[model samples]
Target: MPRTDAGVELAGVSVRYGSAKQPVTVLDSVDLRVGAGEFVVLVGPSGCGKTTLLRVIAGFARPDSGSALVGGAAPRPGRGAGVVFQQPRLFPWRTVGGNLGFALARHGVPRSQRPGRIAELLERVGLPGMAGRRTWELSGGQQQRVALARALAAEPGLLLMDEPFSALDALTRERLQEEVRSLAGRLGTTVVFVTHSVEEAVLLGSRVLVMAAGPGRVVEDLPVPLPRDPGTGVPELRASPEFARLRGHLTEALRPA
Candidate 1:
């Protein structure tokens, strides 16, 4: 379970696009609260505004109404949380170390100290001694590993991920899911992850929130009591009866009412 703290809180949040007279509502009056160190997953059908909600929390999208707060304050554009998108979006021209150094620089970390920190971050993400490799030289999963390292360079208390593993193949996605859940648990980093897969949502989240389509609103908030095993116990966890039951329950919940 997650402890109540100054984590993420949304109040009456809503978003709309197009002309006011004929606007399309993407998110309706929605409210949510996530505790510190909690891994919160956003699951929904396509066009259900999962990414839009993530953007709001990231301070990238201003809501049409209501407010979003991180750490009990309005999100500071680049200060509150580190964001990871679907694509690695690394600087193609930069080496892995260079990319991480750029992030450290933005955070005002001393130039001489970046190498050790970059190395440490790479090691944390399971990519060691590859910092000098060009971003283009790494595989898709490797590039994303670097991207995760870069995001953690700031050591943010909150991590907002937008379908980060969606582009990876099955095995890669599963591996990353296990890695991220373990990382979040070990670092006590609060995460709000968006995904379309029920199994993914259940596997990574301490709390799974399901949203309804057509002006997206949360319809279910389910807690996962499974143990956190990093990557070691993932296969067994997924095969458990509890996991299967929860997965089936969420699948049914996704059906139109």
Candidate 2:
């Protein structure tokens, strides 16, 4: 059931692409509700419209039909919602600090405040002194941290992520996931994350929404009762009875009969 206090709500949402002559449905009627300050992960097989749902929440794409709300208002593109996509998507020409400052500037943050905000954000994401460094000079993980800082600078109510860690190595991926979990908790920011990895979902999300293939739709939405910490690694989690229970549950829900 959809609740007003939910950080985000998607009711009977659907998205379609392609020309009218050859229309294609990417997402079927999708009903999802992410509570305030809740971490919700959307997981499904590739091309299951996981990203499409995130975009809708971020207001990047208008659903062909149905309701999509962020923080109680209609989805508004590039506003109120901050997004971190798969790639860092930083401007190659700008230094790390400058990239974040630009984001603040766009939101009308004063010039005097931009520097402090940039520094504080960088420090929060563990990239404290790399402000002047070009984005390309940093490692993949570092670049993603910068991206997180930029997104947070906007002080968005909802942070939408689309496979933000898919490109990192296994170790780096795990490390970033822990950081993200901690950061989101600290900021009390709501997040709607999209990922193909179940381990990542359980580790970072309070609730995991599993989608089925083709014209993707939510098949299962389950709460993750584990502690949100990096100490919960894939191997350690897999060994735990709870992890096995969740894995088996989601696996069965995601599989097509």
- The global Cα lDDT (0 to 1) of model 1 is 0.89
Write out the backbone clash pairs for model 2.
none
RMSD from true fold, candidate 2 = 3.2
Task: Please name the candidate that would achieve the greatest TM-score relative to the true structure.
Answer: 1
lDDT of all predictions, in order shown?
0.89, 0.85
Per-model TM-score on C-alpha atoms: 0.96, 0.92
Give me candidate 1's TM-score against the actual structure.
Answer: 0.96
Report lDDT (Cα) of residue 24, candidate 1. 97
* lDDT, candidate 1, 133-179, per-residue tens: 99999989888888888888988889889999888999888888888
Model 2 TM-score is 0.92
lDDT of 2: 0.85
